[model samples]
Target: MKVHEIRELLNAKLYVGEGLLDKEIIGAYASDLMSDVLASNYLDEKAVLVSGLNNVQLIRTAEMLDLSVIVLVRGKTPHPEVVEMARENGIALMTTTLNMYNSCGILYAQGVKGFSNERAD
Candidate 1:
């Protein structure tokens, strides 16, 4: 579903990249460590990285990885710089008070799939 579709479907609060509300998202990942995410090699263009840490680095990493959205878990809000970074990269940003697990569950229930094609090395 598109980011705006996600917002409407998930009732998410958009903090940045409002212009990209219609951008589609194919999958989601719940993580706190940016390094782990990088290592995972997300493998989806419209992937949403749901994390708890709200900082500039998160935005930088999201941009670097060409992610579609960053969902802040545990209600953590990103700084203005982070928002601007998302805007610059056209990556949508949002947050939810729901814990990571709950958020992931909700997204899944709403038809957002988790990382597929994952295999043990």
Candidate 2:
């Protein structure tokens, strides 16, 4: 799914990467634990992360993994530094009023798959 399609699907607000809304996302990874996300290794440049962590580290982790979009669930908004870092790293940032569970469900129902491939282990 495209970032814009997801934004519309979740009634999300886009905070960054307005020009990159058309970016394609092949899969979704929903997690608040940055360590788990890093270990999953399912996220690539084609994936989107739905997380509740509204911190600068989220941006760093996404940058390290080359993840394209970060969706802040439960209406959690990132700090200014986090947004700035995301913009600098060219990562799209979005926020949804729905909680993590609902957000994941909506995306999954829209045909977005989870990281079912081999784990980093």
Candidate 3:
């Protein structure tokens, strides 16, 4: 699915990266824990990060992961700096009225698969 499609499906408000709406999303990662995101080997540039946590740290995490899209759940509004940072990093940031669980479910039903972390040990 594309970023714009997800935006429309979730009734999300786009805050940044209007030009990036054409980016393709191959998978999704939903988590409030930054550590979990950092540790996940399943993430790639094609994956979208979904979370309820709204902060600069979330933007930083997405940057570090080289993620192009982030969807903030539960209608949480990110701070000005957070939005600015996402804009600066060329990331597509959006917010949805749906909570994290429903957001994931909707995406899943739309054929958006979650990033699977299969332990090698």
Residue 77 deviation, candidate 2, in Å? 1.9
lDDT values for all models: 0.79, 0.89, 0.93
For model 1, the stretches where C-alpha displacement exceeds 4 angstroms are 116-121
In model 1, residue pairs whose N, Cα or C atoms come closer than 3 Å (at least 3 residues apart or on different chains), thus clashing, are 4-21
Q: What is the lDDT for 51 in model 1?
A: 89
Which candidate tops TM-score?
3
Per-residue accuracy of model 2 over 1-121 as CA lDDT, tens digit each: 8889999999999999997799888889988999999986656888889999999999999999988798999988779999999999998999999999999999999999887566453
Give the alpha carbon lDDT tens digit for every residue of 1-121 in model 1: 7777766655678887777777777888777888877776744667888888888888777877878788887877678888888888878888778888888888899888887446442
Which segments of model 2 are wrong by more than 4 Å?
A: 118-121
Q: Estimate each model's TM-score.
A: 0.87, 0.94, 0.96
The parts of candidate 3 lying over 4 Å away from their true place are 119-121
* Top-down lDDT ranking: 3, 2, 1
Once model 2 is optimally superposed onto the true structure by TM-score, how far is the C-alpha of residue 45 displaced, in angstroms? 0.8
Let me know the TM-score candidate 2 reaches against the reference structure: 0.94
Put down candidate 3 lDDT per residue, 9-113, tens digits, no spaces. 999999998998999999999999999999987798999999988899999999998998999999998899999999999999999999999999999999999
Give the clashing residue pairs of candidate 3, or none.
none
